[model samples]
Structure formats: C-alpha cells, structure tokens
Target: MAEQVQVFGFWESPFSRRVELALKLKGVEYQYFEEDLPHNKSDLLLKYNPIHKKVPVLLHHGKPIAESLVILEYIDDVWKENYPILPHHPHQRALARFWAKFIDDKVVVAVVKAAGSRGEDREKAIKEAREALETLEKEIEKSNKLFGGDDIGFVDIVGTVIAGWIPAIEECFGFQLLTTDNFPNLIKWSDQVVNHSIVNQILPPKTEIVAFMKANWKF
Candidate 1:
C-alpha cells in the first residue's frame, strides 16, 4: 500500500510552514489541512496532539506526529532516499538539530516577545532578540547562501520565521528586530531562503500575513 501522509497546520504559522517546506524539499506528496486556530481548533488536531493541541502535526499512515521539529525529523527519516533534510553525518546532524532548537527556543521566543511587549519589557526583549539574531547572523555568514550550504535543509526549514514571518511582523507591528544594518548576512540569507522556488510557493503573502497580524493583534 502507498504511504498515507497528511499535515495539519495553520496558514500563518511559521511552525506549520516548516513541515510543508521539509515535505516539499523531499518531493513528497501529502494532504494539507488548515486549522482555524486561536478560536476554533479541529477535533482531529486535539485527538492527534492531545498534549499541546497545537498545529504542524504530521499524520503518516494513520499514525500522528506532533511538534514541528519532530515532524521535520520524521519526514526526513521516512523519505531518506529523497533530498536529505538533516545531514547524513552524525556530527553534522547533531549540529543541525542544535541550531533548529536554538531558532525555536531563543530566536522565536525573543522575537515574539520583542514584537508583542511594550516599554521596558519590550526593550529587554529587543535586546535579547538582537543577541539571538546576531549569533545566527554570524553562523549564517559562514555559509554560502543558506544554513544548509547550497540547498535548504533542516536549519533552513526551521528558520522560515526569520525569512517570511518576521518581516511581516516587523512591518505590521512597527518594531524592528532584523535590519540590514545590524544583520546583513541574515538579511541576504532571508532573501535567498524566501525566494527559493519551493519555499516561496509555500509561504503566505506578506500582505495577507500583515492583515492577519493586525486583525489578531495577539503577537
């Protein structure tokens, strides 16, 4: 029997987009289900991911995989023959995993805090976000185009927020987290990643994302 693959995601979620990018990078065909999010969530999503009840869930052959990072690794593992997402070497793979975790735990958190807060708290968040971005900027400076070297890989997929979502958030909220002056390398990488043929197809339009952010205003 052929494999049954499906993705449950939110349209504006970078986390959800991560799974789709990985799948497309591997040339995998799967069904995509968009969740209502924030207000109305699907029962299947809750059933599939009872713990967190969040999106970017991967349903493979009737089994469910929750969490975006875990789903990414799972996709790479199942489609090993296709374009590799994570590196083949154990050390390189470990580094990719480390960077992906850092993007989520530090960069995403700090950027969101910076965009959503105000006054002194916002100042502190902006500092933290800048620090995290600077570290990533230095890391990307070593690469030719993307964190994955020539092609988009694990780290690149995880860093979609930096390329697509962050700019929209920055524009809509009138906050500046990533700038060309402060992070030239990252800015270039962002342009490259967002313009990549496959990635560009999956990313939501910046205007739509801005409108969504304005409507939600939940940061």
Candidate 2:
C-alpha cells in the first residue's frame, strides 16, 4: 500500500511552512490541511497534538507527529532516498541540529519580540534581535552557499522565518531590523532561499502576509 501522508498547517505561519518545505524538498506527495487558527482549530489537530494543539502536525500512515523540527527530522529519515535534509556525518548533523535550535530559541524569539513590543521594550528587543542575527550572519558567512552547503537542509528549513516571514513582519509593523548593510551574508542567503525554485513555491505572498498580520497580530 502507498504511504498516507498529511500535513496540518496554517497559511501565514513560518513553523507550518517549515514542514511543507521539508516535505517538498524530499519530493513527498502529502495532503495539506490548513487550520483556521486562533479561533476554530480543527478537532484532528487537537487530537493529534494535545500538548500544544497547534498546526504543522504530520500524519504518516495514521501516526501523528507534532512540532515542526521533529516533523522535519522524521521526513528526512523516512524519505532517505530523496534529498538529505540533515547532514550525513554525525558531528555535522549535531551542528545542524544545534543551529536549528538556536534559530528557534534565540533568533525567532528575538525577532518576534522586536516586532511585537513597544517603547523601551521594543528597543531592547531590537538590540537582542540584531545580536542574534549578527551571530547567525557570521555562521552563514562560513557556508559556501547555504547553511546546508550547496542545497537547502535542516538549518535552512528552520530558518524559513528569516527568508520569508521576517520581511513581511517588518513591513507590516513598520520596523527596520534586517538590512543589507547590517547583515550582507544573511541577506544573500535569504535571497537565495526565498527565490529557490522549490522554496519560492511554498512561501506565501508578502501582501497576504502583511494583511494577515495587520488583522491578527497584536502589534
């Protein structure tokens, strides 16, 4: 029997997009279900992910996997015949996982805080965000092409927020964080990732993202 693959996701969420991008990279044919989010979450999502009750849940052969990062690793492991998302060497794979965690715990958190806060808080958040991004910039500078080397991989997948969502968030909230002068390496990587044939197809339109942020985000 053919494998049954399904993804529960939200349209504007970078986390959700991460799962989609990984599956696409592996050339996996999966059904995508968009959740209503912040209002009417599907019962299936809650049933699958009782802890977080969030989108981007991966269901493979009726077994549900929650969390984007976990789903990414799972996808790569299951579909080893296709593109490898994580590095082959154990140490390199460890490094990729480390960087992916850093992107989430540090970079994503700082960027969200910077975009959402106000006054002194906003200034502090922006400072932290820049520092986080600067650290990432230095890391990316070490890569020949992308964090994953020649192709998109785990760290790059985890960094979809940097490539796709941050710009929209910045524009929607009228703030300037990531810039060419500040992060040339990151800017170059972002351009490559966002415009990459596969990734470009999955990313949501900037206009739609901005509109959604205006309507849903607290700001």
Candidate 3:
C-alpha cells in the first residue's frame, strides 16, 4: 500500500514552500494543511513538531518530519528514484548541503534584516546581503543553469525566498533588494526557478504576499 502523506504549512512561508516544491517535483501526491502561525498554531503542528512548533511538518505513514531541509531530504530519500532532488554523487551532495545551509544561516538573515530593519540597520543589512548575493552570483556564473548545473536540486529548494518572497518584500518596501544590474545571474536563476511549472504552480501570488508583508513586516 502507498504511504499517506500530509504537510502542515503556512501559505506565505518560504520554508513551507520548499517542502511543497520538493514533494511536487518528486510527483508525490500529498495533502496540505495551512497553519495559522505566530498566533494560532494548530495542536497537530505542536504535536508533530514540539520543538519548533512550526509548519512544514511532513507526516508520512504517521511519522512526523520537522524542518524544511530535513523534510526535503526525507522526500528525496523516500522517493529517490522518482525525481532525485539531491545529487547521487557524495561530493556533489555535500556541496548541495553546504549551500543550502548557507542560505538558511547567512543569506536569509541578511535579506530579512535588510528588508525589515530601520534606516541605518537596513542600510548595513543591505550591504551585507548584497555581498552575499554577489558571492552567489559568482557561483551561478560558473554554472550554465542552476547551482546544481542542469536541474533544480537541494540548493534551489532552500533558495525559494528569492523566487517569490523577496520580490514581494521589495514591492512592499518600495526598494529593490535584487536586480539585473546588481546581480544578473541570481536574477536569471530566480526567474527560472519561479517560472518552472512545479514552482510557479505552488507560489503564493505576489499581491497576496505583498499585502501580508506590508501588514506584518515593520520598517
């Protein structure tokens, strides 16, 4: 019998979107539940991910997997032959994991701080974030397509914020965090990632995301 799959997620969360995209790319049929976060997190979410009490919890055959990156690996492992979200080679896989971690640990903080902080703090954050983006642009410049070379892989899923969320944040703030002139390769990659059918289908509309950010993201 096929295992039942369900994901508790939030509509505007890039982390939750990562798991959604991973499962969709793998052609896995699963149920999705949008959690009300930071206010009314569901009991199921608490039960599944007591440590984080976060969304994007993947429930497979009654087993719970928390953390977007961990859930991504789980999806890839369980449906290994279906789509292969991570590379098979050990070295390449390690690099993918490294970049994914970088995005989570470094890039995200810089970007969010740049977009959400006040005057001087925002300026400093933008500088830091630009440096990070420039480094990523150089990495992408070496590849003909995605960071994974020919296809979307681990890094791509973790970088979901750039494809949709960043743009919405920029719109809400009336400032450009990413642009062709500043980082061409990353912009191109973002377009490709967002335009990919699997990703595009699941992306929350830009207007919705902008409204959400305007209401919640303080400047």
| Winning model by TM-score | 2
lDDT of 3 by residue, 1-219 (tens): 235999999999999999999988888888888898658999999999999888889999999999998999999999989888898999989989998988887778898887778789888987887788788888889885998677888898898877788788778876676888988889999999998888898889999999888787666
RMSD of 2: 1.2
> At residue 129, what lDDT does model 3 achieve?
78
* TM-score ranking of the models: 2, 1, 3
Sort by lDDT, best first. 2, 1, 3
Model 1: pairs clashing at backbone N, Cα or C within 3 Å: none
- Tell me the deviation in Å of residue 50 in model 2: 0.9
Winner on TM-score between 2 and 3 is 2
Misplaced by over 4 Å in model 2 are 1-3
Q: What is the lDDT of residue 177 in candidate 3?
A: 69
TM-score of 3: 0.95
Q: Write the per-residue lDDT of candidate 1 for residues 96-152, one digit (tens) a residue.
A: 999999999999999788878989999999899899999999898887578998999
lDDT of 2 by residue, 1-219 (tens): 235999999999999999999988888898988999879998999999999999889999999999998999999999998999999999999999999999999988988898889999988988998899999999999874899999998999999898898899899877888899999999999999999999999999989999998989876
RMSD of each: 1.3, 1.2, 1.4
lDDT of each: 0.91, 0.91, 0.86
* Regions more than 4 Å wrong, model 1: 1-3
